[model samples]
Target: MARASATPRSSAYLSALSQEIEKKLQRALASPPQRRNLLQELFADVALEVDDRARDIILSREEDTISPADDSHLGQLCFYDVLADYYVQAPESGKPILDLIVQLWSQSFASHIFSLLFHKWLFEVQLDNPEVLLRYSSALAQGATNVFWIDIQTNTRRFQSLFCYLLDEVAVEPARLNKIPVQAQRDLYLLLSRFILFYNSGDKLDTFLKHCPTFPNAFLIGGPTDFFVTELADQLQKLKVEPVLLHYLSNLKVLQGMELRMATSTRLKTCLYSFTSPGGPMYPTRAVRHAAWDALDLLFPLFDWRSRTLHPVYSAHLQRRSTA
Candidate 1:
């Protein structure tokens, strides 16, 4: 008699189950709202099954010892694709489904799932569609923040990579930075600033600051506020990433009538002075001081002092005096 086939019957069974699930999802999307409930139940069932397998695999081996090739043993790779596709198809419903699986799986397992979902969302989708990109990015930012904040130490690299990726994207297409909704922008930028202060170091930190844009709107709401600007200044000074700070400060513009504009200007001015103060490290460094001076000189003209009685000529005179 012929020997048993080399294929694992277990793998075959899982593959068939995945296909059936996909068919059920397609049907669910097409069917009435009541029928969709069955699809939701099926989704929960799949999450439970995958969660069990992932836990067993995680417990059987050490974290770093497990290789990508080992994902097959846990049926993780297949499920990763399936869940991501489900989310892409039905984002509203699929978000909760994805959340359930993440809560049910081990950290490593959840990370792998998130990685796949993020990859699909970032690389596969066309960024030209601003609305679609915003929705997806908001979802991704929220999901990653929720999952990783619990164990930030373990997820440091992921957060760092995300920060760098968004920075690069904005660096390339500066307009995209402001187009994102203020709330989403705050969420992403807050995460990035946290990464910069805690997770990043040396060359990576410098590079991030250097590429940081000068867009006025980028700094208005969700971008760097007064607190972050002050905090980032201290971090950069400690890291001796002063030149990068120069690039950052060079772009600082206090537009007229913006909310908190006066407070922002005051904070920025304090930060600039700190760079060139008597005991500051950059006080003796000509390049850093000059860069800081140039930035300050540029910013001095934009201060809306909001004086009701001061003449325009006096304001102009003061502006000219400061530059002189």
Candidate 2:
């Protein structure tokens, strides 16, 4: 995970940026009354998209050459993206910032900063102490969960790269996944399960399901597929954003042939059915209802077919309503 060394000029620019961040954190620590605001501002600074001018300076090299597409695959570069790489290259330089973060751990946006900056370090650095490793791992999971929820609520993909790294590099990669404690590993998988589709990562669903950790309640939940469906169903119930809900319903087709327990299947069916009607529980919009019906048709085709055969009147009723 080591990054290429930056040139002296770019390195200096990043060092100054780091100093600014450290200063803000230090100020936050000194002023109890303003700690929350300082920390929130710091989070915003790191999360802000890197502008064209800043991007050029941070990425400059001694050779006077930088690939225009260096960060293309990563979507857009953010301040944290450069800082995270800087910390990886110079871990010692980040110690002061890390110390400040630990002191303000309980404050808002603290974990978000930690996750964004140290996610790679957490995996790449060797922690001989199990207790420390677990603590850091827990913070990472919590921070990631918070930020992912931000994306869900706003219906944006701002945190998609973060999700992709955790899913692609850590969750499915056994060597890295095992870097954390078993409990943290399980928690991370479950967190990813809930937000997988929100981040447009449904393509990784099969690999993700294969790598799911064994849950303590597997006897009740069945297995990976069942646990995943259960989480997705619960997630579907909680979503209020029309676009995100439609995205979930559209992606639920991936579960069509997966072998789920009867209870799990029923739970998913009930969750989706709640969205198919314009009623109190779900209050799905017209678009969501149509998407839900399409999902139900894909997941449980025979249910509709059987209902049509046994109760033609009900089938016609649903058909008319759905078209309307």
Candidate 3:
């Protein structure tokens, strides 16, 4: 029964997969005219199925998977490539077209979106691979660090082995990011922005804080709190990234009358006012503990921890939510 046919893993996988396919299809459009035309024709049917709402989902989901060469995007050239219409056509507004598309798609497709998305991405990855997808054995694993934000209630520790594997194995290469084409960079930024919203992912708060200023792909990067801060997290630092963490979290905290303290070398002995809500918006109380954790990230990642210390003045802010 359609009513009973919903599961988190299946849905998340599909959403992730759809994004990969969209990315590959866009990349493929840059090839020779003959191939380009062929690809466009192939997707013409898919394009036809996409109305305004479908357009939004396909465009936003398209960029999450950026290939080394974008061979997958060859799915472009279709009379109605979602990417073609949004990025190629839409002008820069206060909000980008990509964001607009995904927001629109979420209204009706919420239930089936992720599962449908995962299938699209899997097929796209296997399109070039004659073999079954050996790559995605770890794709879900790649997303492991991000699971915390997916549903905080889910036990994240269960996936530790997979996270270790990613650390030991596959991840974003610092070198290749530069070699990426401009279109890809643009596409990814939009994709990241939208997916963060779709996932209701707070993990990106760290990503926003780290890369929002230059968040190349709003949807692509995750905030610091996300345990997924592996190579990609550090690799992004190589470029100028925009940190949007405070902005989003501040908004959330405002509702709960909470205060946020970014990690710094300073201590918070002089600080006051605790964000009482345990899981409403803010996190566990231990300011001294969280501040120390942030300082470690800021000062010496490899150095020892100092239990007794109060240094520079810690910077922090507070907010309350809208009564309306």
- Highest-TM-score candidate: 2
Candidate 1 collision pairs: none
Give residue 2's error in model 2 in angstroms: 8.5
- Model 1 is weakest, by summed lDDT over 10 consecutive residues, at 1-10
lDDT of 3 at 321: 12
RMSD per model, one decimal:
14.9, 2.9, 17.6
lDDT of 1 by residue, 1-324 (tens): 011121233334434554665455455445555444644455345433245564344224333333222323223333443344334433553444344434434323333334434434444333567675565556656555543343243332333333444545542344555555555555555545533434333234434444444445554533334434545545445434444444444444422222344655576566665554345454525565556656655655434458545433234344443433
Error of 2 at 201 (Å): 1.5
What TM-score goes with each of the models?
0.35, 0.91, 0.24
Candidate 2 ranges with C-alpha deviation above 4 Å? 1-4, 62-74, 302-324
| Tens-place lDDT digits, model 2, residues 233-299 | 8999999988888888888877868998989988987887788778788788999988987887788
Give the per-residue lDDT of model 3 (tens digit) for 1-324.
Answer: 001121333234334534654543444333444444433443333333344443333333232432212212323222122232222222231123223223322222211222222322332222334222333222322233233123223311222222222221122222322233334333333334322322344443443424322343334333322212222222222211122222222323211211323321111211111222234233434442243234333433332347443333322221221110
Overall lDDT per candidate, in order of appearance: 0.44, 0.82, 0.29
How close to the true structure is residue 17 of candidate 2, measured as C-alpha lDDT? 87
